[model samples]
Each structure stands twice: as structure tokens, then as C-alpha cells.
Target: MSAFIPLSVPNFGEKEAARAAEAITSGWVSTSGARVGEFEQALADYVGMPRAVASNAGSSALHLAAMACGIRPGQEVIVPTLTFIAAVSPLTRYVGAEPVFIGCDDSWCIDPDAVEDFCANHCTLKEDGLYNNKTGAKVAALEVVHVFGNMADMPRLLDIARKYRLTLIEDATEALGTKYVSGPLSGKFAGTMGDVGCYSFNGNKIITTGAGGMLVSNHPDWAEHAKHLSTQAKSDMLQFFHDEVGYNYRMTNVQACLGLAQLERLEDFIATKIARYNQYKDALDGYHGLRILPFKTEAEGVRANHWFYSLYLGETDLDRDTVIAALQEQDIQTRPVWALIHEQADYPRNEAYHLEKAQDLRAHIVNLPCSTNLSEADCARVIDAVKALV
Candidate 1:
């Protein structure tokens, strides 16, 4: 009997165990331990950001980022249709802003051209800021998600932001070590490129802290205020006084300890991800009409974390769901891309701009298993199973 391969799983060893045990024994297992601050500092340094605020989840970090950006009610934030709902939900649910969904380009990231088209064609630049003429709402910010670890077109997006005088927030939950290979932003990490960026450390991420997140920024005030907002807006050190509405979103010390251990091996995990993706690419070559999606390198020097390897099944006989079923029959786990956010029932009234590419992508992309600890033998089995089905 063959072992079932999972879609994604955490990679942990003695270091994780040791750090977590230390935090648990120290009686600082909740949110007040020293490990949390250390982990936050280490992440900020790694991403080249001046400050980082740890939170309970990526969604909470995003809400804090939105609050820091002053996303007010009746404002609009441009987001992509092909990302996790968590990436855009906080903008609307927490801050009372509306989401203006955009399409994705070849990188499976926000299409800068689409963004420009929407802003230039449908918006008016008033003295206050850019406003959507149709909805009569101020276009306050652009929430860009680094989908599946691929870098968005930051240069173009930055130019658009500058022109419109909009805030830029990065939902870099899946792109922790990804950086630009070549460009002005070369050597800069994904989360650091935006005005404010958020990351996730869920169990399935390249690094795991069980469940955690971090909000980062180059601006001192944004970072400081975001931290204040996350810890229930405590106004004083000795008292439980809160001056404003705040969230109990701080990360636990135990989670931070685990994160520290995972962070130590992030580079190695990224290497393994790249190697496994390459192996899958080679194995699937000319095997079927199937195509293993490549990391975005449209720009001269863009390096991706190669997080989740996906297959485009347009040329294959099987559709996305069929392929997933076939893989399951072989005891290999596979899943389709997230349903387009605009098409989701919750966002029925949300405006979507030219979602053709996103719709097409959602129907054809199948995420494959690429966990860091996935063994060569298990990978081979997965490939063989898929080859047989195709």
C-alpha cells in the first residue's frame, strides 16, 4: 500500500520542539513572552522592514494594516479576483470599505494594465484623492496579494499609486522569502516593497508557527500604530486602558517561539521548494498536454519562493475538477485554484473589472503537492499517477 501524499504540510524538527518547550516551561506561553518580540524583530530584519507587528492570523494583520492606512467607510480598495478571500475581506468587513476587484495577468497576480485601465477610465482624480465615478467612493488604497508566491507588477503598481495618491498594502501571506531578482526593487522582499505588508505563518505555509501572522512597514508611525491596535489599543503599560477600538490579535509567545525555529530554516525550505518544483517540471515534460505553471520572471530578475506548484489543464482532456478526482483516486491530494472572489456569493454586488482572465485561470489551475518535506519517492509517485491519468 502506498502512503497518501498531502497537498501541503508543515516541516518541523528538533529546533521547533526545543523552542516551543522553552516557551511553555517559562510560563510565558500566551502573548506576553520575549520570544514574540524576538520573532517580530527577526522577521522585520529578514524582510528589510524597519518594524513588524505580530498578530494572531494574517486576516487580523490585514485589518490592522487597513486601520493603520485609515481606510474609511465608503472608500474603495482595488484587489485581485484570484486571491484568497482573506486578502480582501478585512477591507470591507472590518473597515467598512468596498472592494473593487481586478483581473490577474500571466503571473497569476494583479494585472497592472487592468488596474490602470480601471483607474484611468472609471476614476476621477479630485483634490482629495482618486474617486470611482460610478460608485461615488474615494479609491483609497490598493491591496496587492503576492498570489502563490509570485511577485505582482510592483513597479507599475507603484506608479499607479503615486499618480492616484493611494496607499499600497501587500498581502504577502504566501510569499515570505520571495524577492525581486533584478530591478530597482531587486534584493527587496515582497512584503517590504509595499507601504505596508502582511504575512502568514499557518501550518501549510513554507514556515509554520501553528497559526500566526505579521504586519510590517518601513514607516515608523504605521508600524507603531498597527502594534498598538493589535494589542487591544492599550494606552498605558500599567493599566488596561484602551483609547480606541482595538482587537485582541497579538501572537502567542509559544507560536513566536515556533516561528523563530521555523525562520531559522526558511532559506533551506525555499531551496527545497525550488528543487521539488523543478523536479515536477522535468517529470511532466511532454508527458501530456498539461503544463506546470512557471514562476513569474517577466521582469529581468524576479525570484519567486515557488510556493505552490500548479498545473494548467487547458490542453488536457480532463478539466480541473476531473484531474483533482483522478489524483484523489490515486491517493494523491490535489485541488483547484480558489474560486474567483467576485463570483463568490458573498461579493455578489462587488464591482469586478474585466474578470475574463481570472475566470479562465480559476477553471484550469490545479494546485499540486509541494510540501518542503515531500520525499523524492513520494513526488515520483505523484508524477506517475498524474501521468497515468493524463
Candidate 2:
């Protein structure tokens, strides 16, 4: 029997361990420590944001961003249904904001046209540049996710947000190293383009903080406010002060130590992933009934981190499940894209719009092994197995 080719995992070298050891030895194992502050600064600089706040998890970061953006009960925020539920779940639960689920375009990001149409029909304008919806609650924000490291149509999305006066909160968890190439926002990283951006350091992400996340913004006050709220809204530093209800969402010093180490090798990690992606493209080229999913580089002049490589099974004689089963039979781990969030039992009652592309992709898309540690032999084995199945 051969080794089981796992789908995705973190790549931690000697530096990661050393930094973690230093954090432990320093006795600053909690959230308030030098490692946490340094990690936040390094991430802020890397993403071109003025400030960053580290959090215990990516979902907490999203929740903090939603709160800072003033997402209130019964308000609407546009979100793509084809994303990890963590991106939208926070808004729904923490803020009591209702998500108007949108569809993904070719980039697997939210379609701007759908957003504009939804706003035009459902929302009205306020004097302060906020969009109020038909239900009398303001459309608090627009959550744009950079799906699978692909940049969304930022120009159109930004224009729509501006015209509608919607706050743009970017869920950039999967696009940590992706950068736009053209336009006014050109040369900007994914998370920096929006009003506020959040990142994840989950095990399968491009970088790992052993379960941590960061919230960033060009606006210093927004980042500070998020930090304040994340750290339990304490007013006075001298006393155990409590002003407003807050959360214990801060990231530990130990996690930040790991994050700092991972950040140092981000560029190298991106290069490796891109190389493997190109190899997959070459190997899969001209194979029948399979289309290599496209990244967002061409449209936005952006370079993706290639967090995970997907294949769109186009009119295949074999169903998606069959193809996945075939790959698994060969000890290759391949899985389907995320189930559409609107279809989930928890969000059964949410409003969903123009979800054709998302629905189609969900049924046909397959994600193969894309871990940074995957060797050339592993890549070839996956390619061979996919070819044999097709």
C-alpha cells in the first residue's frame, strides 16, 4: 500500500518551532504579549493596512468586523453562498444581520451585478450615505470573500458599494497573499482593498497560527475599535473596567509566535503553491470532461496564493461523486466544493438570489490535494489518478 495523500495541511519548519519555544520560555503564553503585538504589526505591514488586531479564530475576527461595521438586527449584508459558512455565520448570529445570499461568477467570488440589482430593488438611501432596505433596516454592509485565493471583480463591486453606500467588509481568509495588479486599488493586497478585511490562520489555510485570525484596516480607529471590542470593551486600563459587552476573542502569544514565523516564509509558500498549480494545469491540459478552474490573476492583475486547486467537471460522463470515489480508491484525497450555504438547514429561511452558478459549481467542482508539503511524486500521482479516472 502507498502513503495516503492528504488533502491539505500546514508546513511548519524549524523556525516555527523555535519561535513557539521562545514564546513559551518568555512566559507570555497569554494574549497580551510581545509576540502578539509583533505578529499584528507584521501582518498589518504585509497587507498594507494601517493597523491589525489578532483574534482567537477567524470566525471571531469576522464577528468583530461585523460588530465594528455597526451591523444591526434585521439589516441585510450581501454574501456569496458558495463560501465557508464561517464567513456569513458570524454576521447572522452575532449582529442579528440577515444575509442576502448572492451567487459566484467565474472567479468564484460574488457577482457585482447581482449585488447592484439586489440593492436597487431592496434598498433606499440615507442622508449619511447608508443604504436602508425596504424592511426599514439599513443594509449595513457587503461581505466580499476572495474565494480560493481569487480576487473578486473589485471595480464593479466597489462601484456598487459606493453607489449604494454599503460598507465593504472583505472576508479574505483564503486570500492572505493575493494582490491586485491593476486599477486604483492595483498593487493592493486582497484584504486591504475593502474598508475592513479579516484573515484566518486555520490548519488548512496558506498560513497557520495553530488556530488564529487577524482583522485589518487602513483606518486606525476601526482597527482600534475592533481590538477594544474583541478584548471585552474595557474602558479603563487601570481598573478591571467594563463599559460595553465585549468578547474574549484575542489570540494567544503562542499562536502569534507561530504566525510570525509563518509570515516570514509566505512568499516562498505562495511560489511553491503556484508552481504545483501550474504543474496540475499542464498535466490536466486537454483531458476530456474536465476543466481546470481559473484563478483571478488575469481579471484583476492579481497573484493568488492558490490556497486550494479545484477542477470543474464539465458535462462529464462520470458524476462528481464517482470521480471523487475513483480518486479515493487510488488513495488520493479529493473532495467536493462547499455545500451552498442557503441550502443548509440552519439558513433554510434566508433569501437567496441568482445562485445558478454557485449551485452548478457545487454539484460539479472537485478539490484535489494542495498541501504545501506535497512532493513532485505526490503531484504526479494525483495527476495520474485523475487521468486514469477520466
Candidate 3:
């Protein structure tokens, strides 16, 4: 049997090891080290943001964004149901905000039309904020996730946000290097275009800091405030003083050093991903209704990271589960896109608007192995296996 082709995994090289050793020798492996701030600055400069705050996890950065945006108890945030629960859950679990689930378009991202529809018909534009007519909660924010590294409809979404006075948050965890190639946001990056952009460095993401997250914003004060809140609001570090509620969400120097190494190679990693994606796409050739879903790339006026590729077998008899099981038999790893968050038992009462596309995508889409270091031979093997199954 050939070697197991696992799903997306970190591609740490000698540079990462060298950085790890450096962090160890510095004797400042904790949050207070200089590396943490350096990492934050590097990320901010990379993404064209004024400032960035590093956190222990991606979810922590999201929670900080929600809190910084002032999503209080009596408010609701429009979120996409097709995303990882972390995108919307932070609004619900951390801030006392409700989520009105929106469906995905062909882009597998929050449908801006549905959001506008909800806001126009079901919500009332009031003096201070937009209010949901039925629930009477202030519609405070709009959180959009760049699912599978595909760019969302930022132009229309931006117009909607401006019209409704919504705080637009970009969950750019999966879209680190994705940037617009054309349109009004021509040179803007996925996270940089929005008011607040949250990123993740999980092992499975385009790049890994082992486990860490960064939050960036053009509003430097928000980043500073988030940094203050992350370090337990240390009003007087030497005096052990605390003013408002805070969290222990700071990223350690060890993680930051690793992240710096990863960041340096981000563009190279993205190129690798793009190459493998094209290999799979050309090799598969859409037989039996099986084709890799296209990201909003050059043709669509965007330069996507191609972070993770989703195989569409919706019209194929092999189906999502069947393909997953068959690939597992060959020691290849794959998974379904995501369980619809609204369909989850925890969010039964929450509103999910027109999830027809999202539902169909969830039923038939299977994720393919997209590791940055995936070899040419491994790519061929995956393509061959899928073709044989079809």
C-alpha cells in the first residue's frame, strides 16, 4: 500500500525548527516576550492592517473582535450557516448576541442577497441601529467567513454594511494570502478589506503557528484595546491591577517565533497549494459530475490561497460518505464540508434563512487532501483513486 495521504497538515521545515530553538534559547517563551509583538507587527504589515493582536487561538481573536465591536445582549449578528461554528459561536457564547443564520451562494460563503433581504424586509432601520422586526433585537454586526479560501461577494456585502451601519467582520482564518486581483477591492486582502479581520494558524490552515490567532483592524485603538483585554487588562503589570473584565488570551513567544517562520514562507506555501489544486482539477476533468469546486481566483478577479479544495460529488452516485469511506480504504483522508450550524441541536431555535445551497453543498461536497507539502506523486495517486471510483 502507498503512504497515507492525510488531509491538510502543517508543513514545518528546518526554518521552523531553528525558530523553535531560538525561542527556547531566548528564555522568554511566555506572552511577555518580544517575539509576540514582533509576530503581531509582521502579520499586520502582511495583511495591510494598522495593528494586530496575537491570541492563544483563532476563536480567541474572534471573541475579541465581537467584544471590541460591542455586540451586547440585546443584539443579533448576521452569520453564514455553512461555516465552522467558531465563526458564529463567538458572537453567541462570548457576547450575549443571537445569530441569524444566512445561507451560502455558489461561493460557499454567506449570501449577501439573503442578508440584504433579511435586513430590508424582516428588519427595520432605526435611529441608532438596525433592529430585527420579529425578534426586536438590534442587528449589530455582519460576520463573513471566507470558507475554503474562496472570496465572498465583498462588493455587495460592503454596500449592505454601509447601508445598514453594520460592523463588518472578516473571518479570514482560511484565507490568509487570498487577495482581490480586480474590482474596487483590487489590491485588498481578504481580512484587510473588512473592519476587523481574524486569522488562525491551526495545523490545518494555509500556514500554522502550531496553534495561534491574530486579530487585525485599521482602527488601531481596537487592536490596542483587544491587546489590553487579552493580557488580563494589565493596568499596572508590576502592581497587579485590573480595571475591566479581561482574558488570558495572549499568544506565547514560542508560538510567535514559529508563526514568524511560517509567515515568511506563506507565499511559497500558497503557490504549492495552487499548483496541487490545478493538478487535481485538470486530472479529474469533471467525470461523473465530480469536479473540484473553483475558488474565486484570477478569472474572478481574486487571487485565492486555494487553502482547501472541496470535491463536488453532488450529482455522482459515489456520494459524499461513499467517497470518504473509499478514500479511507486507500489510506487517504477526506471530510464533509461542515454540518449546517442551524441544523445542529444546539442552535435549533436560531433562524436559518434559505440554506438550500448550503444544505446541498453539505450533503454532497467532500474535502480533498490539500497539504502544502503534498507531492506530485501523491496528487496523482489521489486523482487516480477518485477517477477509478467514479
Candidate 4:
């Protein structure tokens, strides 16, 4: 039997092991180690950001962004229903803001049209900021996630944000290497285009720090504040004095070392991912009802990392569960896209706008094996198994 193929996994080798060993030997394995800053700087340079703040998790980085943005309690953020819950939870649970969920476009990203409609029809621009008429809360921010490494409609989203005084918070946790290849925002990475951006180095992400995240901003103040808040808000070096409420959310030096090593191979990792995605697309073409969702390139003018290749099973006679079961029997792992955030238990009462596309996408998208190290042989085996099952 062949080894089980996972939906997504980290690619680590001797370099990562060596970095870990060095950190262990140096005894600065905690948050205050040199590698932490080195990794942070490396990421900032890679993304074309002025400053970056390292955190324990992507969720924590988002929380820090909200706090640094001065998102007041009872305020609201425009969000997408199609993304992972972490993208929405940080604002609602940690920052005391409300969510107003929007639908996704064909790109499986937050719809710019829906965002405009919501702003024009449902929200009123006031002296202070845009206010949601239904909830009567200031719509302070627009949180856009680059779903499956595909860039969102940033140009239009930026227009709405600027016109309404909404701060753009990019949930770029899944799009580290993704960037616009054309248009006004050409050469800009996913995280750098917004006022603040957050990234994750989780085990299943394109890269891994074991478990770490980073917050970056064009505004130096916001980035600096996020860094200050991440480390327990320590006001003095010698004392445990905290001037404000903060969390112990800083990433460890050990994790940063892993991140440094991983960053070195990011371009190569993206190359492999792209090749694998193309392989899947080429093999599955016209295979009947098994549509491989595209990573928008020419249409969106972006070069995607192709983090996860979505195979929509909606048109097929096979439902997601049946496909999953069949794939599992062959040791090929597959799963449905994330549940719409609005449908989750905690967000029942929050508003979910015309979510037709998101609803369809969530029910049908079967994330295929997209590990960085996945080879042609692995993909062929997966395709064979899927074809055999079908």
C-alpha cells in the first residue's frame, strides 16, 4: 500500500533540524532570541513591508492588529463567510467587534460587489465613519482573506475602504507568496497592500514554524504597537510592568529559527506547488463533473501560490462525504472547504449577506493533497485513486 497523502503538510528537512538544534543549544529558545528578529526582518523584506511583529499564532497576530487599529467595542467589521473561522473570530471574540458577513465571488474570495452593495444600501457614511444601519455600530474595518492563495478583488475593495474610512485588514495567512502581477497594485504581496496584514506559519500552511504567525503594516506605528502588545506589554526591560492590557503572544526563538530556514525555501516551495496544481488540472481536465477550481491569474492579475487546489464535487453524482470516504479507502486524504463562518454556532445572529456563491463553494469544494513536497508520482497516484473510485 502507498503512504497516505494528506490535504496539506509542511516540508522540512535538515536545515530546519539544524536551526532547531542551534536554538536548543544556545538556550535563547524562548521569545527573546536573535532568530525571532531575523525571521521577522526576513519576512518583512520578502513581503515589501516596512515593519513586522511576530506572534504565537495567526489568530494572535489578527488580535494584535485589531487592538492596534483601535477597533472599539461594539464596532463592526465587514467579513467574508467563505474563509476559515480564525479570520473572523479574532475581531469578534478578542477585539469585541461585530461581524457582518459577505458573500464570495467566482474567485472564492470576498465579493467586491457584495461589499459595495452592503456599504451603499445597508450602511450610512457618517461624520466619524461608516455605520451599519441594522446594527447601529461603526463599520471600522474590512477583513479580506486571500482564499486558497487567490488574491481578493483588492482594487475595488480598496476603493470602498477609502471612500468609507474603513481600515483594510488583510487576513493573508494562506497567501504568503501570492502577489499581484498586473494592475495598480502590481508587485504588491497579499499582506502589504492593506493597512495591516497577518500571516501564519502553521503546520498545514505553505511554510511552518511549527506554529507561529506575523503581523505587518505599512504604518510603522501599528506594526510597532503590535510588537509591543505581543510581548505582555512590557514597559520596562528590568521590571514586569505592563501599562496596558496585553497577551503573551510572542513567537519563540525556536519557532523563528524554523521560520528562517523555511523562508529560504519558500520560492522553491511555491514552484513545486504551482507545478503540482498544474499537474492536477491537466490530468483532471474534462474528466466529467470534477472541476478543478482555478487560482485566478490573468483574470485577477496575480501570481498565486496555489496553496490548496479545490476540486468541486457539486456537478458530480458523488457527494463530498462519498468522495471523502472513497479517497480515504485508497489512502488519499480529502476534505470539504471550511464551514461558512456565519453558519457556525457562535455567529448565528450575525448578518450573512447574499451568500449564494459561498454556500455553493463550501458544500462542494474538496481540498486535494497540496503539500509543498508533493511529487508528480504522488499526484499521479492520487489521480489514479480518484479515477478508480469514480
Candidate 5:
């Protein structure tokens, strides 16, 4: 039997071990340490944001961003359904805001055109905000995820936000190193483009800190307030005075130690990811109905981190589940894209607009093994196995 090629996993080694040891030896392994603030600064500088606040998890960062956006009860925030539920759930669950799900386009991200259409046809421009005619809820924000390291149409999305006065939040959990390569916003990283950008450091993500996240923004006050709220809204640290309800969402120094080491090698990891993606694309080229879904590089000028290598199975005759099971038999892990949020039992009452593309993508897209540590020979094995199955 061959070695098991698992899905994405953390790529850590000597540097990570050394840093974690240092954190432990220094006796500052918890939240009260210099490394945590230093890690936040490093992420802020890398993403070109003025400030960043580290959190215990990515979902907490999203929740903090929602609170910072002032997403009060009954308000609406536009989101894409074809992404990890963590990106949309915070708005509804944390801030009591409702989500208006949008569809994905060729970039496999929130379609800017659909968003514009929804705002124009289904909503009314009011005094302070855009109001949905059907639900009569104020459309307060637009949270777009950089799906699989592929950037959404930011130019068009930004224009729509400006016109509608919507607070723009970028759910960049899976795209820490991805940056726009061309046009006015070229060189800007994924989470830095919007009013507030959220990043994840999960085990399967491009970077890992065991489990952590960061919230960044151009506005200093927003970051400061988020930092304040994350620390339990402490008015006076010495006296233990609390002003408002807050969360204990700060990341530990131990996690930050791992994150700092991971950040140092982020560029190298991105290079590996791009090389593997190109190798897979070249190998799969002209192979019947199977096609590798591409990142939005040419159109959006994106320097993609290539988070996940997605196989578009729409044109293929094979059943998605059958292919997955076959791959499992070969000890290679493969999984389909996310189930649309609106279709979930919990969000049955939420509105999803122009969901054709998102629905189609959900049924056809299969994510392949794309860990930064994936070897060339292992990659080739995966490709050959898929080809044989097809």
C-alpha cells in the first residue's frame, strides 16, 4: 500500500518548533506577551493595513468585524453562498444581521454584476442606506471572500459599495498572501482592499498557527476598538472595570510564535503552491471533460496564493461522488466545494439571489490536495490517478 495523501495540512518544521520553544521558555505563552502584538504588526505590514488585531480563531475575527461594521439586528449584509459558512454566519449569528446570499461568476467568487442588479432592481436608495424592498431591511454591508485564493471583482464591487454606501468587508481567510497584480489596486493584498479584511490561520489554510485569525483595516480606530472589544471591553486593566459586553478572543503568544515563523516562509509556500497548480494544469490540459478552474490573474491582475486547486467537473460524465470514492480507494483525498449556505437547514428563510452559478459550481467543483508541502512525485501520482479514473 502507498502512503496516504491527505487533504491540506500544516507545513511546519524546525523554525516553527524553535519559535514555539522560545515562547514557552520565555514564560509568555499566553495572550499577555510581546509576540502577539509583534505578530499582529507583521500581518498588518504584510497586508498593507494600518493596524491588525489577532484573534483566537477566524470566526471570531469575522464576528469582530461584523460588530465593528455596526451590523445591528434586522439589517442585511450581502454575501456569497458558495464559500465557507464561517464567512457569512457571524453577521447573522453574532450581530443579528441577515444575509442576502449572492452567486459566483467565472472567478468562483461573489458576482459583482449580480450584486449591482440586486441593489438596483430589488433595493431602493434611501437617505442613509440601501433598503431591500422585499424584506424592508437596510442593506448595510457586503462581505466578499477571496474564494480559493481567486480574487473577486473588486473594482466593480467597490463601485457598488460606494454607490450604495455599504460597508465593505473582505473575508480573506483562505488568501493571506494573495495580492492584486494589475490596475489601480494592484499590489494590494486580499484582506487589505476592503474596509475590514479577515484572515484565518487554520490547519488547512495557507498559513497555520494551530488555530488563529487576524482582523485588519486602514482605519486605526476600527482596529483599536476591535482590540478593545476582543479583550473583554476592559476600561481599566488594573481595576478590572468593564464598560460594555466583549469577548475573550485574543490569540495566545504560543500561536503567534508559530504564526511568525509561518509568515517568514509565506512567499516560499506561495511559490510552491503556484508551481504545483501550474504542473497540475499542464498535466490535465486537453484531458477530456476535466478542466482545472483558473484563478482570476489576467482579468483581475491577481497574484494568487493558489490556496486550493479546484477541478471543474461540469463537462465530465463521471459522478462527483463516484470519483471522490475512487480517489479515496487510491489513498488520495478529494472533496467537493461548499454546499450553498441558503440551501442549509438553518438558513432556509434567508434570501439567495441569482443562485444559478453558485448552485452549478457547488455540484461540479472538486478540490484536490494542495498542501504547500505536497511533493512533485505525489502531485504526479494524484494527477495520474484522476486520469485513470476518468
Candidate 6:
């Protein structure tokens, strides 16, 4: 048997292991230590955010952001239906808030027009400057995801958020280095544009701290509040005191050591991923019954991290599962796109507005092997397998 090609995996060099070992040798392998502060500062600088707080995982970052944004019971948050459910799960679990599943466009991000339409048709404003839906429930916030490292239309989404007076939270877990070229936030990174943004350093991400995340915000209060809440809302840091409920969501010093090492090599990782993506594009071009999801560089002036290369099987009777299974049989791992969040049994039965595109992508999209360590030979094997299937 040949080497098994993984869908995505961490690329760790000597620097990462050496840093982890140094942290262990220093006897600061636990959560609280200088490595955590150093990692947070480094990440904040890289993402161009004023401040960032590290957490145990990306999901915890999202949960802390939700709580910090004042998400509460009886309020609604607008979220895309076509993302990993982790993006929406925190909103519901942390605040008892309801998630309104919005549709996605070709970019696999939320449709700004759909967001506006949902707000206009279903929601109205109350005297207290809050948005209330036709069902008389308030819509508190909007959580937009930069799906697969593609930049969502933030300018338009911001307009919609302002019109409805909803808090905007960007789920940039998959888009740590992605940025838009033209707009007020043109030079800004994905997670920095919103009221609060979350990033993941999961094993499969472009950068990894084994399992960690960061929450960043332009607002000082929000950043401070998130830090306070993530550390269990202890008002007095010098004493073991707590004023309100909090969580043990802090990232470990060992993970921070890894994060610092990974951050140093992020640009290289992104470059390698993009190069491989272009290779896949060239190799699979003009194949019938197979369409790669178009990455929009011109419209958004976006430089994506190209985290994962996804292909949309267009106009083919071929089933996605069959393609995935075929690749697995060849020891080349591939996976279908995430299940639509609205389709999950956990979410309430909310109104879905024009979710045709999301449904279509869900049924047909497959993610190919896109790790930074993938060599030219691996790319060729993946392209050959895909071409054979098509």
C-alpha cells in the first residue's frame, strides 16, 4: 500500500516541537504562563487586531464572544446554514438564543441580500431600539462566517446589521489570514472587521496549536469583557474571587508555545496551500461533470488562505458519497461538505429563506486533500483520481 493522503493535517517542523519541549522544560506546561501572553500578542499583531484573548478551542472563543455580546434568551441570531455547526452551536448553548438559518451564495458565505430580506420581511423595530420579529421576539445579533476562507460581503452585511440594530459577529475560524483588498476594511483581516471575531488553530487549520482559538475585537470593552468572562468572570485577579459565572476556557502554555512557532511559519503555509490549490485548478480544469468552486479574487480583492480545495460536481448524476468513497478506497482521503446547520435536529424549526444554493452545494460539494505538506505527487494523484471519477 502507498502512503495514505489525508484530507487535511498539521504541518509541524522542528521549531514547533522544540518550543513545546522548551515550555515543558520551563515547568509552565499548564494554561497560565508567559507563553500564553506571548502567543496572544503575536496573533493579535498578525491579524491586525487591537487585542486578542486565547482560549482552549475555537468553539470556546465563539461562546465567549456570544456571551460578551449580550446574547440572551428570547433573542435571535442570523447564521449561515451551510457552515460547520460549531459556528452556531455556541450562540444557542451560551445564550439560549435562537439561530435563524440564512442562505449562502456561490462564495459559500451568507447572502447579504438574503439577510436584508429576512430582516425586512420578518423583523420590526421596537421603541427601545431593538429589532423584534413578526412573532414578537427580538433579533439580537448576526453571526456571519467566512466559509472555507472566502470573505463574506462584510460591507453589505454591516449595512444590514446597522439597519436592524443587530450585533455582528464574524466566525473567521477558517480564515485567520484571509483579507479583502477593497473597502473601508480593505486591508483588514477577516476576524477584525466585525464587532467581535473568532479564529481557530485546530489541527487541520493553516496554523495549529493542537487545539486552540482566539477572540479579537476593535472595541476595548468587548475585548476586556471576553477576557474577564473566559477566565470565569473573576473581578479581582489578585484574589480567588468571582462576581459572576465564567468558564475555564483559557489556552494552555504548551499550546501557546506551539502557536507561537506556527505563527512564525503561517505565511509559508498559506503560500504552499495556495500554490497547491492553483495546481489542482490547472489539473482539473475542463473536466466534464466536475466544477471547482470559484474563488473570487477580482470582486473582493480577497487573498484567501485557500484552507481547503472544494469541488462542486455540477450537472452530474454522480453522487457525492460515491466520489468520497472512491477516493477513500484509493487511500486518498476526501470528504463531503458540512451538513447544512438548519437540517440538524438541534436547531429549532425556523424559517429558511431561499436556501436552494446551500442545499445544492451540500448535496454535491467534496473537499479534496489540501494539507500544506502535500507534495506535487500527492496533488497529481488527487487530480488523477478526481478526473477518473468525472
Give the runs in model 6 whose Cα sits over 4 Å from its true position: 130-132
CA RMSD, predictions in order: 1.2, 1.6, 0.9, 1.0, 1.0, 1.3
Error of model 6, residue 349, in angstroms? 1.8
> Tens digit of lDDT per residue, candidate 5, span 1-390?
999998899999999999999999999989999999999999988887777999999999999999876889999999999998899898776788899999999888999999999999999999989999999999999989999988888899999999999999999999888888789998889988788989999999999998999999876788888898999999999999999999999999999999999999999999999999999999985589899998866565788899999888889897788889999999999999988898885787888888999888888877899999999999999999989978
Clash totals for all candidate models: 2, 1, 0, 0, 1, 0
- lDDT of candidate 6 at residue 82, scale 0 to 100: 92
What's the ranking of the predictions by lDDT, best on top? Answer: 5, 4, 3, 1, 6, 2
Clashing pairs for model 4 are none
Better of 3 and 5 by lDDT: 5
Model 2 CA deviation exceeding 4 Å by range = 126-134, 298-300
Q: In model 6, what are the clashing residue pairs, if there are any?
A: none
lDDT for each of the candidates? 0.90, 0.87, 0.90, 0.91, 0.91, 0.88
lDDT of 2 by residue, 256-275 (tens): 99999999999999998998
What is the C-alpha local distance difference test score of candidate 5?
0.91
TM-score (all chains, Cα) for each model: 0.98, 0.96, 0.98, 0.98, 0.98, 0.97
For candidate 1, write residues 1-390 as lDDT tens digits.
Answer: 578899999999999999999998899999999999999999998988876999999989999999998999989999999999889889776789999999999889999999999999999999999999899999999988999998888999989989989899989999999998777887889988778999999989989898999999868899999999998999987978899988899999999999999999999999999989989999885567888888976365787888999888877777788889888988899999998888776787988987888888899988999999998889889888888877
1 or 6, which is superior by lDDT?
A: 1
lDDT score, candidate 1, position 130: 96
Answer with 4 or 6, whichever has the higher TM-score.
Answer: 4
Q: Clashing pairs in model 3?
A: none
Using TM-score as the yardstick, the better of models 2 and 4 is 4
- Indicate whether candidate 2 or candidate 4 has the larger lDDT: 4
